[model samples]
Structure formats: structure tokens, C-alpha cells
Target: MQKTEKPFVEVNNLYKVYDGFSSVLDNVSLEIARGEIACIFGPNGCGKTTLLKIIAGIDKDYQGKVLIGGKSPIEVRTGIVPQDYDMTLLPWRNTVDNITLPLEVNGYSRRVLREIVVEFLKKMGIKLPLLSPVYKLSGGQKQLTVIARTLINKPEFLVMDEPFASLDSSHFFQIADVLKRIWNLTEVSTVLVTHDLVTAVLLSDQIFLFSPKPGRIVHCEKISLPEPRSVSDPLFVETVNYLQGVFLMGGE
Candidate 1:
């Protein structure tokens, strides 16, 4: 077979099994191009989140290769915003501190870290008041803060697992637009794992539908819808219905 160009992120012959119960991901493989937004969709217990964890380097016990920019996921400069925002944020630190923590840990100078964190805060519509004591903020605010934190590093690749799960419909769309703008501005390759088919359709250049049990990719659909897609548009509706049908068939 002819080889494709090197992908920004590539998973080859991956397998993940816990305690020999069963393989969560069985010989799965995928490739994502630079600056491309790829969403992985699957039913619960289908190992979608597990696959994200493997790509994020949080779970390293899996077999096979996961490459980010031709390097292992742990060795690559990448950022992750998990589905559980609480896990990504430090409860002791305020929002600003939490957002800057990654930069600080990476040894960025104080001035540069502050500037970058502040800019991301503004981009995410996160005001200073919400920056202090993360427990005081609302769910949506916390989620936005997590996103700001993830982007502060200016990473080459971003891994997001249902980053908008807590937001209301209005905030969800607003944040979605912000994420798109940020991705375009930074040219970051993004992998977003979400159960919301509409959000996945709107944000991704390609969508990978996963099989139910083994969580292997069943379909990879290229989205040709025009940018700044209106959710109400007929084309958007048709695409969503088609993907939804695929998901239903997969038992999601």
C-alpha cells in the first residue's frame, strides 16, 4: 500500500487490556494530520475515553505505538483537557494559578507565563473574578478555566475529552467558536473526544466512528461543510443525521 504523509498524531496496532478481562481497544489504528480537528465518537464502555487517555500519555500500559509529531506522546509537547475538569485543575490554586501551572512547571519565565495565561483567559471569556478559588466558580466557568490552562502552553497538539460537557447551549457554542479561533490562530492539531454528535460535526474536519465493544474505527467521514457552520443549516442537519445513524448502528 502507498504510504500517506507523516501524520501529526499516529496510532499503530494499538491494544489496551486491563487484567485480561477483555481488550478495550483491539488493534486500533488512526492518523491525524497537522492542524486537523478529528473527533472520535462511540458508545459508553467502548473505550473512547481510554483511547484518549492512551493518546494523552496518561495510560501507558497499552501495546503498540502512539506517535505525536514523530515522537511518543509523552515526549511530544502536547496539552490535554480531560472530560473531568476537576482532575486537570488544582483545587488549592485559583483559576489564574491553575492556568499558569503548566507554564510554570515547563520553566517558562514568570512574565511570559502571566502574559500567555491572561491572553487565554480573555479569549475564553474568563474574567479575573472567576480566577480565584476554583471551587467558587460555576461548572461552566471551571470548564472554561481548564481550557484556558490547556492552551497556555501553546502546545503543538491538543487533546480534549468532552471539554464542553458542563456548559449551557449558549456558552457551548460561544466556547466552540473560541476554540476554533484559537486553533486557527495557533495552527494546533486537535483531537476532541465527544458524545455530542453536533459538537463533533461542527468542530472537526474529520469524524471517526468507533465500533461498540472493541472500539475500533468503523467509519472515517470527511466534513466538507463551510466554515462557521450554522447548526440550523440544512446541510449541517443532514450531516448530523447521517452521523447519528452511524452512531445508532454502532449502538451508541
Candidate 2:
């Protein structure tokens, strides 16, 4: 018999209330295996972001338990990529500067930072204008910079909330490709929050669908489609459609 591995992340009976009265999350519970990617999918205002925050150890005022690697979130190394890149990246900083921001405070020399960013980007098969101000980069480039910065620390877990929310189809797929490559290389346990079902199916090993306000996981679907998934593939289309139907039914 094979030994069972413990979950890398665990959220049990989670609950979040604001102002001590407004409930946002209700009895939420989940478990993620090491190196697996999990996505929280739901309609807007369904407390998806709130859940991500809890897991990321940003919002700690909630009730219940969330553990990463058998440790509290604050005790774990975490990287966060928020939905808003425009606000996250400093406009005055260049690409390389932005990518190395997370580790700069450690007193590393500029040459070391540049070399680190260059080597990391090379490994990820990503290319960017090292000296170009982030404000001048495209939407995809900005998001890429943010992701690079987040991963520079090589945290135990990656948390992203709607990272591609603002991109067009072209940029959306581009960013998705980059993210897939990164995950394949790092196999880092991740929790991503998104309203896009296609993204959830394409990027995650499992998708957790949440109900409306006072969110709860109504369904958990495992995605078995092979990599390089397409929106037009029959099975891919079927899975997306099935999830859509599930959502519709939940709404009804």
C-alpha cells in the first residue's frame, strides 16, 4: 500500500464576517496537495478574493483555520499577485528593477539583482526591455513583471487574484502561456481566484466553484484534460460547458 501525502494547504470550516455582522464566507473548507494548482472560481462578490486573501495571510480577522505546509499562513513564505497591476508595479521603475523589487531590500548590489532577474527570465523563456519603465510596457508585460517579482522570492505558495482580469484575448492567452510554463517548471502549490472558467480549467488541477455572497464551495471539479488545452477541443469545450451548466444550475 502507498502512503498518503498530507495536504500542502488546508482550510477548514472557514468563515469571514465584516463589521461583525456581514458574512462573506461561510463554512468554507478545502485542501490542496503539494505542487498542485487550485483555482477558486465564482461570480463577482462571491468572496473569492476574500478567500484568497485569507490563504495568502493578508486578511487575518476571519474565523476558522488555514494552514500551509502544516503552518499558519504568516509563518509560510507566500507570493501575491493582486488583480491590479497598474497599482502594484511602480511606474517609475524599469522592468529589471521591478522584477527584483522583492529582494532589493536585502542589500543586494544592482549587478547581482540584474543578473538574477536576467537568469530567471531566461529560464522562464521570457524577454523584456530590462531598462524600460514599467509604465511604458504593455498590459501583458506589466503582469509578467508582477509575476516575476512575486516568484523571485521563490515562495512556498503563489497567490493570484484575477491576474488576467484586465487583458484582452491576445494578452490573456499570452499571459496564460507564461503562467503555464512557470507552473510546469516550479510545480509550486498555487491558489488562483478568477471569474473566468476557461482559465480555471486550463490552469488548475482542480476548480472549486463558489456560490453567491456568503460564498461556499458548491462544487469541486477535477480537470483531467491534457496540457496545452484549447477552447475548441471537444473535451475542453465539454468541460467548460459542464461547468457552465453547473453554475447556471446553482444560480437557479
Candidate 3:
């Protein structure tokens, strides 16, 4: 494989504390290469969400330098899909309106926004007719709508926090495939935070393993499974097993 350029996202000496009782993230550092799908995996309460929030600019009180394309996180034009759909998507708006809200807020012309929204709806497998009234849509549809919203802006960096946690296995893989296809199509750097090991193995080019509270990155493994990897492949199973071992044996 050809070596890529420097990381599009980098976190150095990151630390987060709440109530001064304990640090959620302690001197954690990571790098995500351009066009790579990087996954952050760890036990619950391991500060994975906190780290992603800081990177997404949702939480700014932490101590660290998060750089996106060599600029501060706030300086980079990026998109974020939060773990909670309710937090990221407006309940009152219909799917299309929700997806296009970002573009409208960013001052895109109506015609331009319409064009982008149409393409993203198609990409997300959301039909135009079903775009009305988020409450009318199924859970899976709502999640896809949020993804479409994130992609509609054509961000250089995309951050997803357990976006598939609520989906059934079938829906999860379908969404995962859609995400992979979109990443290939856009070549955008992505960071996905999930507790699901299988999902991480399926979607990531690199995996970052974190330890429990007072979290710190213990391992950074470059996934070498061949492209178009099938979950049934023996090599894929072997890779997953090895990753599980790495996670079980966390080190500083």
C-alpha cells in the first residue's frame, strides 16, 4: 500500500476532567490519516465519547490540542454525527428539511442546497416522499437521514459516534456498507467511535484501543484484512480474534 500523507486529524496530550474527581482522558494521543476510516473502541465509560466530543468541538473545556488538517478543530470545516439521533437531528423537521438545514444555515443558495439534498438522499437510500415528518419514518430511516445531513455539506472530516448502535444486525451492515461506499466516493477522513468490536473491525482501516476510565490509548493497530473483506472469511476471523486479544491485554 502507498504511504499516505500526514494525518488529517491529530490529538496530542489530551486530558479531560469532571468535578476534579478523575480524568476521563489522560494524555491520550492519536492520528488519523486522510481517507482512512479510524475506529475508537473501548469499554463503557472509557472516555471514548468525551474524546470524540472534544474533537467535534462540542466540549471545549478539556486540555489538549486537536488538529484537523493542521488547524484547530474549530478551524476545520467538518461534520459530526452524534451517538444520539435526538441530539443531532431536529424532531420537528421532516427528513429532507433536517438534512438540508445545515446547508441552509451555511448560506447555500436554495437551488444549490436542493441539488445537494437530492443527491445525498439518493446516497443514503432515502426516497423523497418519505422525507416528511421524522416521526413518520422508521428508526433506521431516521439514522440514515442524520448521515445524509452530515454528508450533505461535503465536509473534509467526518466524525461518527456509534451511529449504528440502535440498528438491527441487517440494518447495521447495510448502513456500514453505505458508509464504506460513501467514504470511498468522497475520500473524506472519518473517525468512528463504537463499543462494538465487530463494527470496528468491519469499517476501520486503523483501530485505536483505549483503557477504562482515566482513559488512554493503549494500542493503535493497522488493519491488514484485504479489501472487500467478508465477515465470513477466515482471515477476517483471525484479525478479529487478534484485535480482541489486543483489547484484552491493554497496555500503556
Candidate 4:
């Protein structure tokens, strides 16, 4: 991203501790420009979710300067998809109802909400039953419902905390395509947390590596690759293998 342009999201000297016992973050700092898709990569139990929650303003008891769109994170409207769909989506609600919750809460009329959701589902190629309760759907379908809900408002930025962690390989590819399509279509700035190196390398414009718990960023760099990235391509193979090796070597 160009330094001349204002950052879409910025984290400076961030630190977080829970129950006043142990630190979850340590002096973390980063910047993401408007419309950029960035990913935080780290091991499990590494405070990735904590960091994301802080960034999304879901958790405020932390020491940090987090800004989104020139304002504090809590002041900004962010679309968030948490890793656990079971927790985020209401089990009693149907797919359409789930996606329209935000809209309904914000006073969108019933007709307008339906139109928005129907159009969004069509655009994303999602075919789940609109009235099917969230609990009745398969894991992949439930995740897709969460994705649709996250995007329904056309939020200026998106925060995804390991959104695909529960899915199988086939669903991972499918949702990856959906996310890419959403990014291209809406130009929404996105920040994702994941432990999957290949997925991070494949989707992100820049990848931020994190340490184990007390998760400070260990490293960050842009991934330069042409669109329609081919896994068989030499550059793709080289970058993935290099990152995979670096991560395996404990991100030293």
C-alpha cells in the first residue's frame, strides 16, 4: 500500500492481558491500507482470536492504539465472521433470518432485506434453503450462511477469524473463491486470522506472522503473484515452500 494514502486499519504498540494474569499480545504493530486483504498467520492457541477480537472492537480491555478508517475500531463498522459458526449464528434462526439480523436491527424494511439477501446469495452462488434453521444445515452450509450474513451490509472492511478452519478441503477452496469474489466485488478491506500457511499465501496481499501466545508479529511481507495464481507455478511453489519451511523452523 502507498504510504501517501491513509491507512484503513492501524495497530500500534498493542498489548493485551487476560484476568490480569498473562499477556496475550506484546507490542504488536501493523498497518493495512484500504481495500487490501491481509492475513495474520500463527499457531493454534496463539492469541490470534484475541488479537482479532481487539481489532474488531469485540474486546476492549487491552492496551493498544487501533484505528480503522481514521477512527478508533469501536467507532467503525466492521463485518466480522468468527471461527465458530455455532456461536455467531443463532441456531433457531433460518438462513435468511440469520443474514438479515443486522439489516432488521438497523431498520431495513422486510422487502428491502429480502431483496438484498436474495441478490447477495445469487451473486455468491449460495443455494442453501432460505428458511432452513441454521442448526439443520451442514457445517459448510452454516459457514456459508455466516459469510453471507457478514457481507450483507456491504461493510467497509471485513474481519474473519479462521473462517474456514471448520471446513474440509473441498469447502476451503469453495469459500476461498467466494471470499475472493466478494473482495473483488465490494473492494472491502479485509483482515483474516489463520494458521494455514498455504491458504494465507494464496489469499493475502500481505501475510503477517505471529509468535505463539503473547502473539506479537514476528514478520510481515507482501506476496507478489499474478491473479489466478496457479499452485503448479514455480513462484507459487517457491513462496509457499519457503514460508512453510520458515514457519516449520519456528518462524525464526
Ranking by TM-score: 2, 4, 3, 1
lDDT of 2 by residue, 1-252 (tens): 353998999999999998999999999999888999999999999999999989998998888989999999988889999999999998888889999998887889999989999999999988788899998999888888999999988989999999989888898888888889999899999999999998998899999999999899999988989977988899998999999999889934
lDDT of 3 by residue, 141-160 (tens): 77888888888888888999
What range of 10 consecutive residues in model 1 has the weakest lDDT sum? Answer: 123-132
Q: In candidate 4, where is summed lDDT lowest over 10 consecutive residues?
A: 243-252
TM-scores of all models? 0.91, 0.96, 0.93, 0.95
Better of 2 and 3 by lDDT: 2
lDDT by residue for model 4 (70-187), tens: 8877877789999999999998788898999878878978878888999889987777889888899988889899989988887887999998899998888888888888888889
Q: Candidate 4: misplaced stretches above 4 Å?
A: 249-252
Local lDDT at 187 for model 1: 82
Q: Per-residue error at 184 for model 4, in Å?
A: 0.6
Better of 1 and 2 by lDDT: 2
Candidate 2 segments exceeding 4 Å error: 1-3
lDDT of 1 by residue, 123-145 (tens): 65556554479988777778777
